[model samples]
Target: MSFRIVDLAETGSTNDWIADHPEDGLWVRADRQTAGRGRRARAWTSDIGNLFTSTFAAPQPGEGAAPQLSFVAANALLDTVARWVPRERLSLKWPNDLMLDGMKVAGILLEGHARGVIIGVGVNLAHFPEGTERPATSLAAAGIAPPSAREACGTLAEAFAAHRRRWREDGFAATRADWLAAAAGIGKPIVARLGNADLTGTFEGLAEDGALLLRLPDGALRPIHAGEVFTLGDQA
Candidate 1:
């Protein structure tokens, strides 16, 4: 499907703007966001040099579950980033974050609306927020000059289209395999913060349906569908 790209010099949030203007195959991008946000409504630092964009796309007939798109978006974003950085240095974090050399370099936020699902992506191309919950890094800091926000949006649109097709044709099994192969912290000790409660366990592989399979100390397994996950020893 062809995408309608809307580039704004500044906005409150690309995701919010997309939400207001819901249309399938519409891509909203902003040079800077005054009120950008991530999952859980956490404020995202929207500097001028980074990439802030969101796109609207219909879910496959049988594959509209929210979490599924997170994986698809992760795969797409990872694929786009791989073009500029070494694949070995990039990894997919559970739920919807991208890691570069063990630090967060990009994040994905999925929201469902009447028109379609909004896939909000924020990539640290030229700058990353400091003193954040997790360590953040930018592509420029890693010695790579990323494409402009507009250019990156075009690349992301193409990549997302391809991955979306792959998911539709092969189902979650295919996306799951690809996501796991690039997953970080698998089989490692980690902490999952669910509201006021925090659960510590080994980061088992993802369930077939996309839930996080966390193996606790008592030899029991817990399927986490939502929460903030932090690898052991990583400052949260």
Candidate 2:
């Protein structure tokens, strides 16, 4: 499906903009954001040369459509970035963040409104924020000249449509398998901070419904529906 792209010189946030102007098949992008944000309302530094966009789509009738779409978005991002970066150096962090060599290169945020769900994506093209909880990297810092925001959005829209088609036809199992194959921190020790409590465990993988399966020290398993994860040795 072709998406209607609305390019903005500056905005508060693509996600917020799309939220206020709810419409299906719309892709809203801004060259610079005055109020960009990430998960848990963390302020995202909107440098002049990065990709900040949001796409709106109606949720499929199902219990897990939101989480399933998150996986679809991740796969689409992986497909787009893999063209310029080596596949071996890139991995999808569970739920949203995309990593390049263990550092965050991109982030995805999904918000539901009266009209549809908005998939907000921010990629570090020419610059990355400093002093973040997790270390961040950019395509330019990784030695490849980053694509223009418009070019990257074009690639993302195409890739997202392809993955969405696959999800519609093949279902979540297929997307889950693909996401797991490209997942980072699986089989490694990690910490999950779920609001007030923190749990340290081994990253087993994902459950069928897309919840994170974390095996604790006692050998029991915990399904984390939401949290911030950190690979054991990485700075968080």
TM-score list, all predictions? 0.96, 0.96
Query: Which residue runs does candidate 2 get wrong by more than 4 Å?
Result: 61-64
lDDT of 1 by residue, 72-174 (tens): 9999999999988999999999889999998899999988887678899999999999999888999999888878878888888988888888888888899
- Candidate 1 regions exceeding 4 Å error are 62-64
10 residues in a row with least lDDT, candidate 2: 59-68
After aligning candidate 2 to the native by TM-score, how far in Å is the CA of 127 from where it should be?
Answer: 0.3
| Residue 218 displacement (Å), model 2 | 1.1
lDDT of 1: 0.89
TM-score between candidate 2 and the true structure = 0.96
Candidate 2 local lDDT, 63-109, one digit each (tens): 24665789999999999988888999999998898999889999999
Clash count, predicted structure 2: 0
lDDT for model 2 comes to 0.89
